[model samples]
Target: MTWTFEEMDRMFHPRVVAVVGDKKDRDYMWLRSVSTLKGKVYSVQVNPEEAANIVAMGFPNYSSLLDIPEPVDYVIVAVPRHVAPRVLEDAIRKGVNGVMFFTAGFAETGEPEGIRLQQVLTDMARKARMKIVGPNCMGLFNPRWGLRHSPEQYYDDGGPVGFISQSGTHATFFSLVGYQHGVKISKSASMGNGIILHADDYLDYLGQDPQTQVIAMYLEGVPNARRLFHLMQEIGQRKPIVVWKGGQTSEGARAVQSHTASLAASTALWQAAVRQANALWADSFDETLDLVKALCFLKEPVGPRLGLVAMTGGQSVVITDAFAKAGLQVPLLTPRSYQELATFYSTIGGSYRNPMDMTPTSRNLDMVRRVLDILARDDNIDAICYEFNMGFSAREGMVERLVDLLGEFREAYPRPFLCVLSAVHREAEAVGVRQALAQRGVPAYPSFQRAGNAFRKVWDYYRERRERGATRPAPAPAGPVRPG
Candidate 1:
């Protein structure tokens, strides 16, 4: 079936749901799945005795789908693979719209019989024209609808990010990480095996999803390469996409086959696709979250030139190298601006060329503020990175001063300001300061490389967006390949 934003809305936000399988002890579905659903939910257990206990605990249980009085919009199949086909048959007879398989032992098992059973389920689903999420997946997790994987997990009422991953853990990973780091999320889904619904389908859905402005994905492989590339190009023009494509190496590719029973596209082709779509590619999971923070926290930077302030002169060298390698510029200040900066201090030991050093002289909070204020006004500087290391041993109230200064800079300046914590972020005082800054929507990095990389991604996105003009042009169709 064709995919669209409205179709996604109707399918994911279903009115009625059925959990078809053997009931687990303590009613796991009632606590984790059914309790979270914001719609009418009923479970179909084959054993009448277990069904009685399930209904007694909390959720309404049924002996079979045929006995239920209301129509089922979605089904979560948790039975064994051998029993799944019959459940699908029952669902089709009952006119179910979608199914998410919480059961494994299908294609991922690397057995011929499992593959055949998966094919049977796929054929039945095709004839019925129903969307299937996974034969080994956790399905959809949406905060607006209160859909989640774990009962203890917290869902942000309405976040700004829509995430889809091949692994269920990655979906849960983002939610846990986002909750602690202040990264708001709208949707997190694990489309396991991706047999029926592909990753590109979610891209189309998220591209027009009004609640989501940024899309993040963790992909192992795509069945239709051309479709994925075109869809990414279409979505990239409207919203930014941060993708972490797995199986880029020979070893990783072998692992991919066993993991999902899908072919791993060559790294060269995958990178080309990412470049063609003008989407951001991440090397590590931390970097993936880094891109999310950059997109969510900082505004678009005007240029790539960065102004660095440090706690020590030695740290300046490290910060400068990191910035340069990350595709950012550390430009030399004009002689006039240099001389104006020298007015704040003596020219003997103080250096004012660029990355205005505040470590040499004794720093009062006001003087440091003026120095940053001066650098922020310069046309040569598009973004500012300040290094702060604090001690709470009555060290002249360093933590408070730095926190206050950061707040003021955030209020006064329009450019993106970064806090470089170096190795000091591990300190107890620094951790407190970091959280404070993050709460104010200010980004604080533990090291120079991370800080530089985050800013570079932010710059590249805005620059590309600017060059492409205000609107992204739709791509022309290529031969016989067209978006389904």
Candidate 2:
């Protein structure tokens, strides 16, 4: 069944969130989750030492979940397994909608008794009509509603990406990339083990979520493969679903099982499943983030042909080879277009090929604008890949010009235009350049090859959708089209 707005809303924005835990966990949950949460937040701690400090962080600290004088709509449990069952018991008794278990040691322990205990807990919750998020999970983070994974980790300006991961570290890292890449997290859930709510549950909620335009998942294994596949296909028809299936290799599969108590699927089988569901797949954690950033910032390209404008002849040759290697075409420039760009080229060097090179002497915002404009008007190319060395550009103070030039070029050509900002020895300098480009709606990569590879994935996704006769949405009025 699909998640209704009301149910999901209550799940994320519980009116009274009871933070159920003790000792070190009490501080961790309060500092991490409760610090940024909305509604009436109360800590249900067993720390008698600090019991008198009821107004710690401006929230009352109670002895137990039942002791919290108000009606608790949700419970965030971080207690031990022995103590955790009682918290769930009290939450059900309190008529709470859900209990998010921050504690581990149930089925993932691989013990018969531990497995039996989880089953009993699920049965108890089911009888009370209560929902459980995880036996070993970090729970949800909805920034729009003031929920967060951790106050120190989550960004306040959450954007359109809603991520659901089987790993907490993956979810945390994914959320942080937005700060550097300009992608944002509308909502996310680090669903460890996924004992109760499951990956499919979060997918169902995000599918109907208005704030979420792109659904990204980092999964170790599938609980119900058939159900997950059909659900992804149904939702993927409307929105882009990027899945990064972890543990494709046998060694990695063993690690994944140990990590999340999940048996990983084979690489070939999982890949076929993802493709059949019409969802995009990423081979690594970094690639998953890159794909999400590309989807969030880029306008759909109508064709696969690329226009590469480079700083030097060597860089141009490298970019051309990179795009070609990535299965994207770097077509020869049209005679008319080549003639127009050749006007800005110096007498020393340049090329009229697909990856046209411009002399350093001619590198400026005005010339870059003209070159980009010439390429944009060409029917031979559908997207532009502008490659530049930012660290070296600082010599001519062209770095400032390139920054402003990215905005102007993007405004003029509202199609998919990517920037390849080469990283020099200085890591901080590269970060500044990347952030600047991200602000202008351009997805930047460390190398031209990486940028081209990401763009190729975007093209292939739309191309596959077209072959299947599915609807592919665009940022503008024109949707994804092929070269007829």
| Candidate achieving the largest lDDT | 2
lDDT computed for candidate 1: 0.75
lDDT of 2: 0.76
Residues 301-390 of candidate 1 have per-residue lDDT tens digits of 889999888655666788899999999999987666677776775545456667655665435677678778878878788888887756
Candidate 2, 422-466: lDDT as tens digits: 766666777666767777777788777778888999888887888
Best by TM-score: 2
TM-score, cand. 2 vs. native: 0.92
lDDT of each: 0.75, 0.76
- lDDT at 133 for candidate 1? 87
How many Å off is the CA of 179 in candidate 2? Answer: 2.5
RMSD of each: 6.4, 4.7
At residue 350, give the lDDT of candidate 2: 71
Error of 2 at 170 (Å): 0.3
